[model samples]
Target: MSNIKKIVDIGDKELEVWKSGKGRTIIILPGMMSSLAEWELLYEELSKEARVIIYYRAGYGKSDKGKIPRNCTENAKDLYALMKKLRITSPIIIGHSYGGLILQEFVMKYPNEASEIILVDSTSYGAHKLDEVEIEEEDGSSTEAWVEKCKIYSSLSKEVLQVEMAEWITEMKKNLSSSQHLEVEEFMSNPVMFESLSEELEHDLLTCGETNQHKSFPNTSTIVIGRDPKASITEMVESEGLHRSEAEEIELIWQTLILNQTKLNYKTTYIMAEGSGHSVHLEKPEVIKKAVDSILNSTEVED
Candidate 1:
């Protein structure tokens, strides 16, 4: 089926949005340093059964670069504006990685906007606090390992940045075409993408803390997706210089954080998407569809 793509103006920022399928509204938000291209396959698959919407946030893809000091609060404000501009309401929202953090802020700020929530191996609400506290990797590495990596990415030249990024999301983008790959490449090529990514990460602690400060989230139907540790443990040890034990510790924290989110929701379901790392939606599209179908079916039954 044909997917409609164009620029959408949400006040000062103009976002690039894609629309496909023709059933209930399904809104998918990508992670930090990510774009619509990375999850095209999943979008297409989901489009076959439901209306699908994915967009490039400011500074990514064709979207305009928003002001600096960008954090979850600002991002949530933008998302609300975009939803209003699109006249969307009660959409089933799915977030992956940083997108999940954004989802938390959004539901907290605008409780009636979304009918359902799905987090695909998403960032924990308070994981950013690790940047403040001590998190020793195997060799007693600095707690800023991940933050340092983002700083490096922001400093690299465009060509180097693209290559560095291409090395990642490789398995998840296996279905991506050369053209689609170009879209991803173009996204990485933008200096603003790196800048925006770094800023968001820098403000992550604030975002998490602010989300915590907000009153408890409204009673919403939510789903939390976690990854099978095997998919990422080896990478953490080999690529990230983490000891196996350290990696296991981090994984334990992540799993615990995910499970705890369910307690915050009035109705919730937690599922582990296997055979993939953090980008579970890309590696296991069927599982995402399964989640959507289950929720849709339950809603139908409730009605």
Candidate 2:
């Protein structure tokens, strides 16, 4: 299949988008820290039967930098703009990590624009608030790691950081080839990316609160794909060198948020990706492919 890549100017920002195949459309809003290149696995399989659209969101990778206060709501607006430019309507939208929060904002704002939502290990609504859960840790958890990464990205040379992060990523994903790490390393090595990343981090609680304002989103068919937390907890314990108890507590918080999503969406099915961690799309892509195909088949049958 011929993969078409182009720059789409959506008003203020120019977005780098890649598309392939035809029939139905699938829009993937990857993690803010993610690369469009990293979605090659999904594109390779899904594009055979569907029009899979993956892009570097404004201010990430090759995409033009976006406006300041790069909160989730703003990012959601960017998604809407991109869709409007491409004349896409009622397409299946998928979000992972922070992208999920952006998806929530989009659904809340546009309501009827998406036919379905597939949340893959997405950051849950209101999970950042202290009152959202009973257990709280004051010393810092994963945030500390992100802060350290920011420092490292700024301090290290691009060549050095690229090698180290490539090896680290390969170990973490296990299935990814080192060749695939180029785009990811390039994005991470840029100190400017951390600026946008940190701004998003700063406004995360605000975005969560705003998204939580919409308790009843459109009754669009929704599917939740959560990675088995055991693997993630083990990663936190080993990779981050955290105590088992700390990691368990962190995982517990994450799972609680993920499970709470079921109560918010109508006709939602939750699936846990066994032997997979946070990056379910990378580790067990077949699960996602099946999920997408199921939703697409059902949608077409109704159409």
Candidate 3:
């Protein structure tokens, strides 16, 4: 049975989590607004070699939201505090999407906390490069109304974001005209919040510039996967329409501009899933599992 324990006494609410396995310590952090349970199937495969630690962020999962910071920096701090409390030394860190950004920040703040880091089709460019997508309201007012709509249509959009479907595209288009635009301006304005989160991401890229340390992590057996440019998909709601070319460019930004900025300590294996889109893990779980397995077993890996 999967063991899930709420971590208490820590400043920020976190959880002590794992399935079953023993060897290296692997810590798994899911995407933003996601729960640790998201790893249900992935854990089955990864736990075969090492103990997997999947914790719920403060605002996510069973963890309470009070007193917990939602941005990336605070999120990383929470993970660090949890590790210290649990007495985990040099555990391997694995992050997906926003989770990846948190780990990336943590690594910069505390470079030696992990024996290795694995990024699974994650967003690394930070808020600056993140696609500013918004939904317009009927009254021509721009608000997080889109995210609110998302919360309402969570069940359906969840599948759409994870797996590309024509219906989702159609629904998104239906709202475009009546919807108002909300840019990242609001998200970027919170310095104590947003800027702090972005700093770590910028540092990671900066570190890469001084030295192509990308190979170093890989030498330590760290692995990273980039989304396929060709298979990328974007949904434009209402009046918004994502042309095939634009979607492909988005993938290129991640692979060519964002991810490529890092010079790995070891040879990084870049695999592109032709059939998959942004959410590669959901679109192709088997492929993700295979990649994870290979990295875990490879002799080049340290932890």
Candidate 4:
């Protein structure tokens, strides 16, 4: 019931693809550090009613890692090229996390390509600004004082702390949109690439956060935000300098940003997945599916 193949000339690398169904076209984009495998459930469900195309991004899954740019805009351009290569027109896009951000870029950058967007736990900022974070050292001195900082880079990133609560760990892992994999493993192994990617991602993500005002979609869109527990929220508020009101404010700003830029008289829906984190798809796929289906049904094409 499923067909799998590889396309070698899409982006800077090959895209491993799984395609099914035969009706309206839908492209499923998974989160960073995740591949098409993460969309198995949603793919299966959507395939029953629509043609679904699922593929891994460059540097993910069976996709090759070439010398292309790694920023979200580049990723979105690659996606557009792939779809054009495959001759798909006006597809419905299901994007999660970084994939969601890529979809946003695609919709804004190529307004004619997609009919709608489903944003799953996307990050947004009213302004493209980054917080200045302090790096702590074990010696209680500034990171500048550490002479061999590069030596400990690999150790710090790869080190996974042992969890005392199995249930909580299981739940946490379930809710993650992405996780470490072979490519991530390789990046973590190479200190230079690791640090380089981190710094690049820092600037890229800040740009994405700030450029939210310029991004828009032409059709219908929906956003799902996974709510962490009150305890977790409290901790984030205290440690990250974000109050509960700030979170609410950010959500409101995010909605307004997308709604204003949308060109197709866009209808927007917002869903809050309670007791979950950013990884609502993995932690609560059913909830996401229900929300997605609701949007698709509401915007069903007339006969």
Candidate 5:
């Protein structure tokens, strides 16, 4: 992988943008709390075929904390500005998880600036309606209520914050080597990381609402890669005190929502990444590369 990196001044803040390889640009947007480093494997593979543009979203990695609202529209605006400043137009966009929502907004806002889009285990508008699930909380409220109550994390000390986020860190470590673990640890130590996560979580509903306002996607080739809901059924059942049947039902609903997301565009394809949960790109980078290659090859043929 090349080590070329630069800072782009995006009005409110400077974003750390990394670019490598050559040919058509493939701009990658990371999920909430996910940094550009998480895209290392896929970036290396895709960069071999085309120019890969990955950046640290504001408040992640080497980027400055942003002042804009942490909603999908604002995030898309930042990306549009960055691409304009970099003189990149009509590039392929790949969004993972929350990044998927941002990409939806981007295509909606810019309409004609994207050649194609790939969504990796992305959040769906139907899934955004958390009220459909009846997972009760300690306060007799639903899981959505608990999520709203727990959004304030900016004031926690580093030690406490680390403990709170230990589960995910442990999961990430399972896939990383010692050096990678150390790098992840250093990134997690940044207080801004937690703050940014909190901001995103707090405004998640608003982001979905904004995204819903757009009725159609731009006329572009699109791929929606969804995770196997079965892979996460056990965890969901245990954590939410759900019965086996209930968990299975919820899983079905989740999968359905993911499938329905493809309806936003006429030219759309859906693929299920079996055995991979939400982080399909991390769990199955090769699958992502195949999808990307297919898109790039098709683009080549069209040109």
Candidate 6:
């Protein structure tokens, strides 16, 4: 497969997009604080069967940082516009983490434009509610504390930033292979990554609020894959200061929320990645590939 990279002007700003393979289009949407390179493994695998479009969101990679107040609505609109400009029709949409929320808004607004939707370990509507768990920090308010931390992160020297990012990539390598981790590390080395992430976090609450309003999503073929909540129960309890029992209860609540996601559509399938964490696509690419293939094959049968 050959990679075709291009910059498309989206009125306000330009987005860097990469396309490869041929056939049905499958657009991969990256999560918060991530670039298209984060999907390198899955993109390589999926592109073999279908045309894949991966783009850096505004403020990441070579993409221009557009205006602020960039909540889910704005994100969804930008993606829809890009698809229209590219003349992509009824494409399969795959969203990871926060990208899933944007996908939700997209399907709701342009129901006819999407053939299927796959949400990989996506965030729940209740994600904005953090008061249930006590997050460890010097300040009581986690949001305010996080904002202050971002300021510190933004001010770090390039060498210190690289070191910090390397450490993070090393931790992520536990879930991803060495090469995959290296690719992600290289993409994240861009200073703009942190800045974009901070800007996204600034509108987290607003984004979730907008998502909450769209409880009834379009009735389309949808797949919801959630990482096993058991994988993080202990970490949540120990690090987040939640009681052991509380952590277990929270896990159950999370699973319930994930299951509830299927209610958004008429034909929806839910899967749990047995040993995977939130980054199921990276940790268990086979699971994701199988899901995508299943959707594609099913779509073919219907056609």
List the pairs of residues colliding in candidate 2: none
Expressed as tens digits, the lDDT of each residue in 161-270 for candidate 5 is 67876776776777665656765765666677666666666566534544466456777789999887777687666655677776777778777777787787789999
- Model 6, 57: alpha-carbon shift in Å? 0.9
Residue pairs with backbone overlap in model 4: 127-210, 128-210
Stretches of candidate 4 exceeding 4 Å from the true structure: 125-200, 209-266, 299-301
Cα lDDT tens digits, model 3, 1-303, are 555454554654544444467767778887743434445567767777678778766544335444532456667788888888878897778788767767766776676788767777765643334343332333322223333333333334333333433443343333222221111121112122222223333343323233322422324445676666655554322123555555455445567643552455554455665566656556666766776667567635653
TM-score of each: 0.87, 0.86, 0.64, 0.66, 0.87, 0.86
Which pairs of residues have clashing backbones in candidate 6?
Answer: none
Question: How large is the C-alpha RMSD of every model relative to the true structure?
Answer: 3.0, 3.4, 9.8, 6.7, 2.8, 3.0
List candidate 1 segments past 4 Å from native.
129-175, 210-212, 238-241
Tell me the TM-score of model 3: 0.64
* lDDT at 35, model 5: 52
Candidate 4 on 83-112: residue-level lDDT in tens? 978899878787876677777777878877
lDDT of 5: 0.76
- Cα lDDT of model 2 overall? 0.78
User: What lDDT does candidate 1 reach at residue 208?
Assistant: 57
The window of 10 residues in a row where model 5 has the poorest summed lDDT is 138-147
Q: Which lDDT tens digits does candidate 2 get at residues 1-303?
A: 998989999999898898999988999999867766667888779999889998877667777776655778788898999999999988999999888888877888888999899999888766565233223353443454455565556566767766757765555344555666666667766665666676676567534555447546777788989989889988877877767876787788888888987766667899998988888888788888999989978877988
